[model samples]
Target: MKRILPQPLMSLCLWLGWLLLAQSLAPGDLLLGAVLALALPLWTVRFWTEPARIRRPHLLLPYLAVLLWDITLANLIVARLILGPVRCLRPAFIRVPLDLDSDLAIVVLAHTLSLTPGTVSIHLSPDRRVLLIHALDVEDQADLVARIKQRYEQPLKEIFAC
Candidate 1:
């Protein structure tokens, strides 16, 4: 079973995605989706170095809820900033220390930060110990660093802890 569907969830998503893209539930599409779902994971499995394993999987829902809420709030704040005076803008780049040992978790954290309103994940240090983030506006750099650590990094550490 494992060999047949190396990533079962990915397979299911591929099937659903194929159907959605095709915009039809015809028998041929179903067959093609099933084949692609089975084949893609098998072909690409070799490229994956390590499989992801969530430490406290139960916290995933709460984490997602918090992320969604933050994203929404960020959108509003960014919109306001954009519409307001340009002179008040205080854009800066800050380095955020990484506690996540897993590459996958670190990548997810970076992506999440990028998805939020005024912040963008600039780069990760070569040692992978720190992530560089650029913020569009900031009154206090320390506060921004602290919030990123507390709100996003800490949760990711817990979620991806080994």
Candidate 2:
């Protein structure tokens, strides 16, 4: 069973995604979707270096809601900053210490920072202890670091339990 269905969730997603993409539920489409769903997972399972597992899966929804809210607010703030005087912008790179240990958790944090409006993840320390992020306008580095840890890292630590 493990060999036949290496990643059942992925297969199911692929199946559903195929149906939605094709916008059809006809017999032939269903058959094709099923075949692709089954085959794709089997063919690509070897490339998955790490198994996708969320330690605190129940926290995912709330975490996502918070992230989305932050993203929206960040967008508005960035727009306001961009419209203001160019000289007022203070771009700086700040190093955020990592608390989450898992590679997946680290990846999520980096992606989250990059997704936000005024910040971009520039580099992660080779030791995986710190992430360097570039911010468009930062008044205080310490405060920004504190906020990132509080708003993003804390939730990710809970969500992935890493």
**lDDT (Cα, tens digit) per residue for candidate 1, span 69-157:** 99999999998888866767899999988878898889889999999999999999999999999999989999998998888888888
Predicted structure 1, TM vs. truth? 0.83
lDDT of 1: 0.89
Q: In candidate 1, residue 35 scores what lDDT?
A: 99
- Give the per-residue lDDT digits (tens) of candidate 2, residues 32-61: 999999999899989887766677878888
Q: Which stretches of candidate 2 lie over 4 Å from their true place?
A: 9-43
Best by lDDT: 2
Q: What is the TM-score of each candidate against the true structure?
A: 0.83, 0.79
lDDT of each: 0.89, 0.90
